[model samples]
Target: MLDQLCHILLLVVVSILYHVTFFLPPSWVSVLRISVLLLCAAKPVSVMFTELFGRFRPMPGEGTEGAGKVIGYLERLILVILMVVGEYGVIGWIIAAKTFARSRQLADSQAFCEYFLVGTLLSILSSISLYLVLYRW
Candidate 1:
């Protein structure tokens, strides 16, 4: 319960940062919002709750097979985040440069940097959450 609340609050903070920083198209923004919200609120909460109810693995036991799989899923998000960062940091600037050829009002570098920052913040938040979730120490 406490964990869920913490995650929700973090998600809210991340959402605000994303909106204030990125200039994503409405369609992409909506999709990104839903994806982040679902993972932050629903996925981890469900994992913890289910573990509480069904079965929990001992710290060093053979019965904890699913633990590795769950952890792998969480860890892979970091790789995805790295890709997102590269895209926002580099590809975004390229696009902005191209768009600038037509419209002089767009601040491609600023937009890219903002998106990169937001992505970094989110990845950090999620990674911290994962550490908390996976490690009891």
Candidate 2:
């Protein structure tokens, strides 16, 4: 139980840092840890979705099936939101939530722009990949 809680806490931290930094937690150790967390989060969600919807089983077997559908769709939608949120989230995490060009909150302007650009590019690429992954079979 405690171990699970710690894992959850680590996920929250990693996700939080994901937006703030492209290759978050720069150290090799931190990067590896974060990568593991991301893999952990993503794998379960995808597997559970596939299992519940196994072989076109959109709602899965039973038990928490209904709840899973609701939560799964909601979660997929939230993932899209988070993708966009990372746009300003990174900037805000560094600057202020009210950050803008006019705000003059460009502390790490160069680094921020670089990271933001890469993030945006990766976002588009990932969206396309996500579409193909979900629909193309």
Candidate that would win on TM-score: 1
Candidate 1 residue-wise lDDT, 1-137, digit = tens = 89769878977886586766467677776566545644653356435444543343223333345653453344335433443444435434543443454243224345434433443344345544543442222
Question: TM-scores across all candidates?
Answer: 0.30, 0.26
Count the clashes in each prediction: 0, 2
Summing lDDT over every window of 10 consecutive residues in candidate 1, give the lowest-scoring window: 53-62
Q: After superposition, how far is residue 58 of candidate 1 from its true place, in Å?
A: 14
CA lDDT, every prediction?
A: 0.47, 0.43
Clashing pairs in 2: 52-60, 53-57
Which numbered prediction scores highest in lDDT against the true structure?
A: 1
Q: What is residue 70's positional error in candidate 2, in angstroms?
A: 21
Scored against the true structure, residue 124 in model 1 reaches a CA lDDT of 44
